[model samples]
Target: MSTFGKHYRVTTYGESHGRSVGCIVDGCPPGLQLAEQDIQPQMTRRRPGQSALTTPRNEKDKVEIQSGTEFGVTLGSPIALRVLNEDQRPKDYGGGGENIDMFPRPSHADWTYLEKYGVKSSSGGGRSSARETIGRVAAGAIAEKYLKDAYGVEIVAYTNSVGPIELFPSTKEHPSPSTNPAFLDFLNKVTREEVDSFLPVRCPDEKVSQSMSDLIGEFRDREDSIGGTVTCVIRNCPAGLGEPCFDKLEATLGLAMMSLPATKGFEIGSGFGGTRIPGSTHNDAWIKTPAIAPGETKPNVKQPKLTTKTNHSGGIQGGISNGAHIYFNVAFKPPATIGQAQQTTGYDGTEGVLAAKGRHDPCVIPRAVPIVESMAAITVMDALMAQLSREAARDRLQQAGMTNPAMMTATGNGHA
Candidate 1:
């Protein structure tokens, strides 16, 4: 399970306190221009010590490409990436007066990890640490580059909420952000630059971003933590990118996002709010694609012949993409390794007060933005490659004069 994807496979290695952490990216198409600079920006964003609201652990998170490229072009082979763990502090977890070595941190992977393997790392959460995501971010950067160069796809994620503060709060009239005109408009146009402009919080909304920053500061000062949500959107994805049954596009997306550390919930499109509306109103109705004036279309991008009048289905239908924007929200729980002292049990079944020691964010939503975007890119890239393989096979069949008349008639309109 450490490896993901069918065509674009990524297998990550190393640990939190390990010498280095990284991944091996397999199946990337050859001849695309790539370099360390292309992957460094996202690594910088995901690294710790970004601002006062984040963990104090300082890591440059500098990435190095070990192989699979020559003269800045991929060789269609497995690419290895690595980032040194420069800020490791194993003694903080056990060597000091702290008893974390004896008791598993509450609500953390410490217990389940030991239970599953009957052993654990001397310090830190090992593979469960947020540091493990460095490899994922690096791999995602490669996938994202391919997606952009080949399909003009754009993936963006931002802090949607911190604690109870939200960019678009649900109300009596609008239980879902999908029902809000302003939310829809923002989704249609928000960019990564705009999202990053509001640093420390990354929520885009001026007033709300400031409020969320203050809220995170409050939690940090109290030696506590809070949970929040991240919203992501994938634009310009081609239609027919998902496989039906178990590998549905959204289902895979949910699997990717939920796999991240501390993620507790996942929902797509209208999400849970759609449950409040009736089926008649919740369903997305199809319509002819909107007409664009001459020169309005972006170069190298294709437009779908059909779209939805309402996107309550979230750009996906019947487990396949419909060439509309795909959006979803990922919920992260509060960081378990807080500075507060809690009454808990130890391995010997004894009761005591355990004051945890470590550097952790009071709120993980801000840094989670890039992680969400990266995971989205990986999922979309995998699905896209799968779809492309099928299309290529069908093309060969048609060119060989083996096309079925009934199938041709069924898809005569050329719609995916």
Candidate 2:
């Protein structure tokens, strides 16, 4: 609810050791081409202290855009952005009222955000921090540069697995998923510069990315934290886009990845493993060729019936978009500010033995793969601007019945 797309909305504010975090987007699409060096590479890849397995708290999350652009383009208004919050320790996670701000850190959002807003923020875990997804990877990099400059649309994500060491691609070097190719031809040619050249832990195979970076360095040397799965794909997302039976496009992409911040789970396309097959092998059989792009004729190009040979409905079906290649999966948990030691109870109920501090991330799936490709490019660019406002209101009711013949008998033909 803290705003996300209805039309690429966004919203996000600040909190986790506050002073700055930021967002605001609001229905982008003006003169595109934005700046802040294109939202500082996904806010420096979802910022943290770079790497030693994350969270040493160096936060150089430099973004700024302080207003919908002017010279660098985009004046469709309401952009905002911002970053700051230097290295807000907030005494790690307790300082003000001690007892680690009176307990409650297990599986975070401290006691349901102080029982839904009676007061929370003991620094971090305020907006249920993962630094509140840095305004969703800075408004999903301007809704992925307006869905990759209007519909060449390509959103990639990685990490695929960690807690279980799954990167799938094996002739036996470390492959499993019935032995490689469960999904990956680099997910139809990967790129985010080849997932940052498998840096830190992006996991683009490399023998399961060195066994998922040696199991996140043995759970960051046992201070402990672990959880995984991030897969995303998207390809050229045009077709009918989505929206049916309640804004379905995988239910607004599982409500923009379960409104991120330790997202528990979500799946799409053959998800839940295609319920173990057999709807005649999961029925996606339709085959017509060339909808466009062969003869090079352009009268508002509309060739689009040739996508499925076998997409397992990941490119969405019935719920819309049948262009193909949509894929999904996001699981992320295991980051509730651990440093080990815990017995629980506080805020006056006694008990003791908390032993937590800060500088987290034993494994947040390589910074949650650009926040699941910026919440799937702000939920497929707000379902492709609600299918281009329903094809511009059906081409303005077919151009008002072909240029208003008799203007419907000059507006006096109701029952005359």
Candidate 3:
């Protein structure tokens, strides 16, 4: 189904070259502080043609709140958002039959999508294109705000690799979770709190960031492309957010990761390498500490109620949040639409060589970070709501003749 979710469903429509692309959020608790600015920064992150490494297709990518809110707040109705395509060059991308269709790029879903659906759109990958992720990212931003304000959840993501230059490289043959700016390891480390800290986020390690940038700059001029991974982490997450069995946390996360374009691989916590480790090494043992402040209060913010010794589970345990650091990695392949020409079959079933037209990101991982974060937020917030609702429902059954449902207050708190 094009739509996803049980309690908090999101039905996204439109296409890359279509008039617009957006999402319709079904479940939202009204009266959360929200504004147009909340979703703007996220759109800017995935916006086409932003940096030298990305495609030059600039589409203002502005957000239009069509429903779900009156002034600037959510009205509990379905939150609908639409982003108009500002800069589009359908002529640049011709495919299938005669001069209309060029050679189909390999590793792209062009043909598979067509084979499965029997029909495709001109320009962009239609729904297959990264352009389709706008609606997801938009919905995610909203979810992020809700979680941040209500439960104080924070999620952050950044580039982790390119070709062989791995930022959060594994340690002792296993992926070690660390909050190193990777790109900015030299100056001050970027954290989840600083939303805009990574602006044009360069490598914290001057030498590394410059070297990577130089490599990208040179390749951009050469019309070549590259690929990498984006690392993301969440802090101060309460335990018991994910549903068991079918609706597991990792299951939901996989849905989001696999949905992005050019994403080759996905991993959470120790991932495959952990398979080699014994249970003693792979298992995460839990401990208790002072209460943590909400997601983004301050360093001195309330003592975190939840704490962990080792985050072997990457903050999630038993298909749910264990209150540790939640982290994962998303793999991306080099942009197939390079300036260099490659041999391929035309849409008409003829052999030909064609250089894929248009501008695109050689490395979508860095920018894809926000998209990933948005999804994580959306999923986590939905899961959180699910947990809270269940708790509320259980309490309702216990209070039978209770007249004041609002007076039910909090269902229950895990610990002091």
Candidate 4:
């Protein structure tokens, strides 16, 4: 059920607190460079110890390419990759005993997980932990490279909100947030302690970040937590990557976002904003202009011609990419784990009080930016591959001189 994609599906298995977690990507074309190093960068980005506002777990999260490659290039087989649970916590809370069933942490999915599976891991949050995302990020990194090399696709994401620290739409609307000098300086220079010291309102929004911090400080003085959203951008997507009827580009993107932990909502392009517009008001008009040199163009040649007076389509339409910039927003809920003590139950399954004794984030949204981008890259790459594979099939048919109507097309239908 973890499978994603019609042709190039990636199924991930294992638990966060399990002995290991891994992913198997079926349908990868052979001969691409596949190595542990290729997947490590993305894993490192998702690693917990990167900042101060995150968990204290100092896991290297090193990856091992177990199959589908020989001497680095893929063997045209399923790619299996994994990371060991090297920093697993002991099952004891030191309160006389570790009654994991009874020592449930507040805001965590422990109760729900137990209800569904009847058992859970005592180490971390078990399967509900963020650690499960490593497999996804790893697979995504590979997909990202393939898409980039094959179709010039680029994927990126930025922190849009951290509790009250939200990004207000620029009156001038620059190309992106991370591109601004002040914003980029803040992100690259501000330490976790600096960011964590603020209230829920001020992480990225100066005013809100400040005000939220004051309120959260009062709450922190009392012990509390918060939530927010992240914005992802995908560019240079090729046209016709996704199919119609089903597997629409936006549909697949939404599925990938929903699959992540703590994601409560999602929106692509003008998402809910289109409701306020009439057809004329919301429609993105097309206007062609003389092509300007886009990137490293030859001195004498202009860039390729493109059109789109507006981006209301979010770069996709009719379930397929229109070869435009694709962007989306993902909403994450407040971290379920909080420091406050609450009334719960014990392993004997009896009523009791619970105080969370482990280290956890008051917010997961800040760190989730990379995860959302990774999933987007993954979905885009898969769709791109499906398009390429179909093209390859058609080419083969052409070589065989199969001119029959059914054999030349990919609709799975034929009639001479």
Query: Which has the greatest TM-score?
Result: 1
lDDT of every predicted structure (CA atoms) = 0.91, 0.79, 0.72, 0.69
175-290: candidate 4 lDDT, tens digit per residue: 33322345434432443244334423225456665554454444444456677777776766777778666788899999999989888998886666555545684576777734
lDDT tens digits by residue: candidate 1, 211-233: 99999999999999999999999
lDDT of 3 by residue, 1-416 (tens): 56867777888888778889999998978987677798898888778767666777878889988888877778898998999987777766774332335556777777887788887776767788888889988999998888778766778786666667765566664535432234223112355435344434333344545556666666677778887777777766777779988788878887778777788788887676666677876665556675436783443223345566655566777788776667788888887777777777887889888676576776666578789888888888788889989889887886797545555445644324
* Candidate 3 or 2, higher lDDT: 2
Local accuracy of candidate 2 as per-residue lDDT tens digits, 186-250: 57778778777888898876778888888888888989988988888988788888889898899
TM-score for each candidate, following the candidate numbering: 0.97, 0.37, 0.86, 0.80
Give Cα distance to truth, residue 195, candidate 1, Å: 0.5
Candidate 4 TM-score, true structure as reference: 0.80
| Whole-model alpha-carbon lDDT for candidate 1 | 0.91
Candidate 3: lDDT of 69? 88
- The number of the candidate with the highest lDDT is 1
- Model 3: weakest 10-residue lDDT segment is 179-188
Q: Which runs in model 1 stand beyond 4 Å of their true positions?
A: 295-299, 409-416
Displacement of residue 14 (Cα, Å) in model 4 is: 2.5
Candidate 1 residue 184 C-alpha distance from true site, Å: 1.2
The reply for model 3, stretches above 4 Å from the true place, is: 95-100, 173-189, 192-204, 291-307, 400-416
